[model samples]
Target: MSSSASTTSTRTARPVHTTPIQQPPSDSTSRIPVTPAVLRSIFASSRTPHEERSISRIAFFRFAGFLLSCVGISLAASRGRGIKTGAALLGVV
Candidate 1:
């Protein structure tokens, strides 16, 4: 009985402090938007290198070009003499 009575129970936990804390780099970069308005905003963002220009910018440029072409063609056609110009002027053709 003498040897068994001398011992006392104790508890221990596993070491949990080995992980080092790390801080992320500062947020100094501009973010890109992912919306329909992004197409419009992109032009105002920067004068980028030609090779790095985005596809959305190309699409917007193409659409503007197409609209201008239509306007020019309509103007030219509207100037035709007599029947053709009359049809255009009346908004019937």
Candidate 2:
């Protein structure tokens, strides 16, 4: 019996050369200090009238939801016992 074998050759990869990136110089004088007054001015000056109204409306709705949750919790507690017990729990009684 006769057997046949095949031979294969592999090539090694070469490393690529790249140039280093250059960054712009930063000036300390150009940077602004974040004080409370600067932040307040930034936030106060950037808001439009519509944005102000939207913010107020959102605050009102959040307060209303909080009140509604309190009432619902009181009602659920009272349902298990009595209205006086629920009011006592909420410090109203």
Candidate 3:
């Protein structure tokens, strides 16, 4: 009984005696935080002027395709076709 009581007391006291590890506060400006200017600078340096124009052209076509798809789907739906069927025709479903 005395050994068991001593073991229990040692186990409880060990955790109470130990201090929690802590980290020091970090500096607010230590990191180069990403902003819009930082993003533009990164892109500007990574791509040539021609490559940038090609990328913009691809993006424009993608946007135009999306608009065309919306128009097609609306026209189909207005023509008494099910919206799901129209979307399926556009491979959207």
- Counting clashing residue pairs in each candidate, in order, gives 0, 0, 0
- Model 1 off-target regions past 4 Å? 1-53, 82-93
User: For model 2, what is the error of residue 86's alpha carbon versus the real structure, in angstroms, after optimal superposition?
Assistant: 6.7
Model 2 Cα lDDT, one tens digit per residue, 1-93:
887877878889875757666764587787688899898778868899899788879989999999999999977877899878767889996
Q: Estimate the lDDT of model 1.
A: 0.73
| TM-score for each predicted model, relative to the true structure | 0.34, 0.42, 0.46
lDDT value, residue 10 of candidate 2: 88
Off by over 4 Å in 2: 1-42, 83-93
Tens digits of per-residue lDDT, candidate 1, 3-93, equal 6566787889877888887765566465454687786567546655663466658888999999999999987876666677687879999
- All models, RMSD in angstroms: 17.1, 9.7, 11.8
For model 3, the stretches where C-alpha displacement exceeds 4 angstroms are: 1-25, 29-32, 81-93
Give the range where candidate 2 is weakest over 10 consecutive residues by summed lDDT: 16-25
Better of 1 and 3 by lDDT: 3
Lowest lDDT sum, 10 consecutive residues, model 3, at 4-13
Q: Local error of candidate 2 at 77, Å?
A: 0.6
Highest lDDT against the true fold, candidate: 2
Question: What's the distance in Å from true for residue 77, model 1?
Answer: 0.1
